[model samples]
Target chain A: MKIALDTIRHSLEGAIPGVVATCDANGIPNVSYVSQVHYVDSNQVALSFQFFNKTRGNMLANPQLTAYLIDPETAARYRLALLYLRTETDGPLFQNMKAKLAGIASHTGMAGVFELRGADVCRVLDIERVPGAEAPRALPPYNWLTVLRALGQRVAGCGDMAGLFEEVLGGLEEMLDIRHSLLLMWDECGHKLYTVASRGYVHSGIGSEIPLGCGVIGVAAQYQTPIRITHMAAEYSYSKAVRENAGLDPQRLETAIPFPGLAEPHSQMALPLLASGKLLGVLYVESAQDMRFGFEDEDGLSVLAQQIALNLVQLQQAGDVETDTAAVAVGASPAGARLQIRFYPANHSVFIGDDYLIKGVAGAILWRLLHYYVHENRTEFSNRELRLDKHLNLPDIDDNLEARLILLQRRLAEKSSALAIVKTGRGRFRLQVNQPVQLLEHEVGAAL
Target chain B: MIGSSAGIPTPMSTTAPSPPVLRPEDADFIRSGVSVCVASRDVRHVPSLARGLGCAVCDGGRTLRLLLVKSQSEALLRDLEKSGQIAVVFTRPSTHRSLQIKGSDARLETASSGDEQLVQTSFEAFADDLLTIGFSRAFTGLYYQHEKSDLVAVTFTPDDVFLQTPGPNAGARLEPLP
Candidate 1:
């Protein structure tokens, strides 16, 4: 029976390393262990090109070869009669294989020794399963397609950006059973990704930043590809690097919110939230169990990420159109102790009474909100007005006002309980503050 | 071409040593619970491979006799019958310690006296070995299970022995075999 390459994708995820057998020019056969066998498509797969070994020599001489893979879960074996194709040194496939190889190397204690030189593409001429090799097995616990559909519905039911973030993050836990996860939005101008929403952590880690091309999440965002690391490697863990990212500037170090990534996650997966080639950000999930997220989980999460990205795109565009510029500040402000709000335009850092609240775009948005509340005596504002506000310096096309509002709202709720921003209507919000406040704006400084 | 995870992957470090003889430790390691795979190629140069049930080092570590399930190794057995060249890799999962033994002459042989017990012992040992590395013993038992009647041994006098452990020196010849 002809086997489609996708049907057995779990076997190709390198959960159990595969063996590649090739014949040299003299018809002498040689076999070796391969760290990864990446599924390119229905008809092709890419093997990691590590060194110019005899296997490489044989492939150049005899393109026809055999590769044996075993399912990590079932242990069922299959043989792929592959015809060697071209090698890819760059692009999504190469990046994916390279990232996977890094994790394998780190897990195997061969980090620097195991480097991916290229991705050796192979045309799967045939796939034959070892007969009677499989023992009777129980059915899988979950179907990713059904779970993804349910997640999509949960996200679509939300009416606002905060609700959307809440639903998606909540659905990941409730529906897919992904307890530890976070939502990040791309800061295109800053060349970073910031945590907008998170779940299953003691600290929300909101406003935590990771530079592009740094850790798993950063690398995922940089290449716009999904990265799955089954075993925790020190260099790939984002928690420490995120702190470093936060401390890139001395001022940022002082104001950096604690990065809430798992300190020692055994399994980590980061899928880039991309929409039509442009990356929106990244959706990251992690666990303390070895091999928690398999290939199917990655595929499911990628689907969910795309859904969230599309909705986010729609939500951001919708924020631009739904404007009530003449909205009035309602409800009398309560009397309380005076709170001094400091705004640093350099990094858009916001602090109240020496306590840092948030920075980056969210901080800038917070400053703009406090400005109107302090001088203009306004509480209610529209997203459109904020988008149009030139002083905020938000990007013109993908301003991402909704995400910034969500971040600012979450941070304020966590840090400053007395001052909170609540959505009033579509594309509008009311900043509720019980205490009297003083606004102090500072000069621009370098940001991390 | 044969390698596992124990060696560095540097090409310069893989310079071949003199003819390798399997050490007493290699024989002991082979008899322990380690995974095995056998490779052979057809006249057309399309190689074939299959999971090995177990391996037995005979003739004071100079020859290797590998166990394979006949049903799963039809093509490989056919290749071996056509071209007697063979390469077998034995690897311990827990440590990633691996060895590749190659031969120019491979012969098909039926299970001899005590071979069934060897298969069962090797399977349990391999399964037990895998259990230490997080694989459930029961699951690995079923994965490595071999029926007595379905087993066949492919015996070969090894002409080459190489360090197949992954890393830079993976393909380097294992010299001064005992």
Candidate 2:
């Protein structure tokens, strides 16, 4: 498929996503999609890619690679970069990159990619950068798990739900440099748009309750559609609760609250969080910059919000299902002498602590250890005998068993200061602690 | 791997001794992921023991524990007397050769001697070592009487050590556990 580089560049500049590829010394092939790619120099360019899967594998095998963006619509091709293979570098590539990409980087506010690659023989230096990609979508387009994982960080491991909302809004504000961000919840019981959380807003709790079908949020909730109000005065769905409450100038409603920022809050979007046929919540995103929430942002954030809602449901359900067999006690405080403990409800979410947390196979391994301890009285088990016992309980595949345990170890390391989970000596493992660990507290069934 | 010449079986029974030694051939069997069959016989009625030896090639360490059942229940006492008079032997880890017991050792004929006996004589045999020998379910469940005891069968017990299996150069020795 020989295509003109200028045509591809123009198509990419118009709105075409790029395809990434890399090869090793052995001629092994790897490919992926890149959202952001910029030139470091005429010969080199830097690209940022989410870490995982085939791309990581290729990088490990060989760092030398090439990335290209093709515009089938215009038969244009943009040869992005041909990277140099090196673990160590002190080149002028980074400086050349900051000049070409600093403006977009500042606008997007994403971390700059450090790795650089020289240009291939064919180059289109004067090609305009495409704001969006327009092409035939692949089947099962985005890798769901990876996208979920990337978005999972926004909501996962939140200590307090309400408090995390504020933090999340702040992070989103920082990322987009939006003047204002507010999270509205349509209280199913209350039937009102209660401002549960917000950022860049006044303390008077302005525009608190927008009844169903009353305002932009109300229309969003009623019609189950997003609202992007560029002008509040002309918005028939605009209902100002603060203006109504103050009882001043019903006729001067549009002039009452002079929200210069809201009047021209260039880009705004309201996405409903629907999961399993139920609308749990809605996300309202607005930016001071014009045309900020485009189709890409709308689609991505809507999917992201949907994931959050699904995960929220999972998180709630997870609390009901005991993830860990042994319940460790929490801090002993508040009630003076009363002791408190918390067990990780069995689920994939890793346990959290200052120095230790149970994750993945580590949880499985810990579960097994606890199971054995509960079943039989043992302080230490030899590796030789442990496998025999573990095999009796699980499959005899050692690699599969160990991989899970490693996940648990990493999670534990992240959660707690104690790196003393896996011990080795005399070919046996022993849990060492004089005081009863709060981590092992749980409901004891009739059967041990 | 130095220990007794007695090798252990996989899926060890609860009654089997702990820390059972592994045999050289048993190691090969385990490594090969192969399964083996263990069998018992009554040589008196089935006197084709010599012919059966040829079929024991795939049997690895073919161990034969022959039990001589009494033809007549009453003749068990006389049989026990002779069986008790026979000697026994055992093997060591260091030496691959067999060591036999000395003198007139007697197998107890059902504690006292008033009960009916099933087998007059019982001999233990293995390719490697001799730790202990046990009776088969058929032999143990038989109707028997012991004299001067609560109706028990003639049960013979070895007093001194005896060579359970033949020599080391012929059969593999047991491997020591961790």
Candidate 3:
């Protein structure tokens, strides 16, 4: 163990193919080139087990193996002595390796053949640098530690849900120079992920819906793991995935809201925001350049995503407290023609005249607010009361309520309707109705 | 059997050398620009791997000559001494198309006068191919940079050839093109 295995992760990224050596008990050796050597932790690294080949057989019979890792940056080589720990068929490790293998395979013209079945976990038994004159160590583009700390600080300064998301995604652009990204909150009841915040797209797509398990974002959410692809593969493309999904059922309005994504992003990473094993959302980032988000970037963003998830739980729950109901003035509406506020109770869909505004739980919340406004003459409300209400049917504390409110708010702004939900304070907000609204509930067997 | 421990030994084999199974097309591919790696194991089956400078297939496509630097391949050379068994892989970086040839009896000879030109040609081809896939000239230099005086020739008659192009067909026998 002359050197730590953690620092040489660049070599293990499989940017340059790595050589893996294994042997059966007969003293006969088998050598193969592996596409990726996944950095599982400080003591272990995993290789994608794409097929049940001689290497897999040799490993199971005699776990002793050697891996020759060459740094893509420095061309420095190292020999890792690893003991086969176990093969993970499913979990964070397998899913992560599967997604990466898919990207590399497609990039290398091995698209359909490079399918991952499991992750071969190996414990680092020894590590020694192979003494050779290598290319000089090049400086990385920017210090990720500095970027991470600054982003964390920016998120720390945020007091509300909207600002928190903005600071996180905005920090990626301003600090890390990552241009395109989306922050999507998982809708548990609907089994879909809705865009709550986005950056670097022609269309904001604030209310875009992607069902769980369609594309990279959906897969990341489905497995509660990060999915990163270095090259664009049509099978994993969001446009194709959503199109295939809609082809199954074209009548569904879920596909109506176009997903804001690049046509052919070379590199993309979707990191799940996990809080105590519960997935809050997915923070997706992409670039037009190949291998743009390397292993280190994924490591940095995964930590940031977890922190964001925890902060979201705390911030959203903290917003549950009722306060500032009377501090903000509820201004009178301007004289204008009353517009029809159409509601479909079946899916909780709301329509402003003819254009679809929103649906699902967010739609239900908006309708409730409008209902109370029309009947009880109430203008201000708190998130605490919404969470306690049984009618809203909010999922658990994991990525709930506040995110939906943010979605509702963004949708209203996206549509530029007469209605607006303005945050008055930490918890209280006023529903500013610029035009008088007529409530029309459209349900089967109900008076129109 | 973990990497730290050894498993039951399958008694030492005294198998005879078999004829080359490398197809003519694969022979040409191996001789062309490709990332070459040579590997062997100690008596304990603990394998050692080393990068190859370049490669050449000769003797009517039966013999495989791989050039490795003596100074950088001490462990691999030591392992090959005890177990003549060897496995060499050649991969084209741009397409990721690859093949592996295994030899039960491998021999190391001093790099020849004519072998220098053969190795140099492959180096340029491999470097140029890697450049097309975004590898800088300096980075590609790491594989080709070696003193001609230190180059050792590892020669073996291929016993079997396997398609190692990283797909469902990987590790399968390299069938001849129809």
User: Top model by DockQ, which number?
Assistant: 3
lDDT, candidates in the order shown: 0.81, 0.36, 0.82
Tens-place lDDT per residue, model 1, B82-117, is 688788888988778888877766889998756777
**Ten-residue region with minimum lDDT total, candidate 1 chain A:** A246-255
Once fitted onto the true fold, the runs of candidate 1 whose alpha carbons sit more than 4 angstroms away are: A106-113, A243-255, A327-334, A445-448, B1-20, B143-149
Clashing pairs in 3: A64-B3
TM-score of each: 0.90, 0.27, 0.90
What does candidate 2's lDDT look like per residue over A350-437, in tens digits? 2333322332233445655544544553344434444455433444423223223323333344344432345433233453222333
Q: Which has the higher TM-score value, candidate number 2 or candidate number 3? A: 3
Stretches of candidate 3 above 4 Å error? A243-253, A324-333, A390-399, A445-448, B1-24, B167-169, B172-178
On lDDT, the leading prediction is 3
Interface RMSD over true interface Cα atoms for each candidate: 6.4, 36.6, 4.5
On a 0 to 100 scale, what is the lDDT of residue A345 in model 2?
Answer: 29
**Chain B TM, per prediction:** 0.84, 0.22, 0.86
Which lDDT tens digits does candidate 1 get at residues A295-357?
888888888888888888888777767746675755676788888888877767888888888
* Model 2 TM-score (B-chain only): 0.22
DockQ of 1: 0.36
Better of 1 and 2 by TM-score: 1
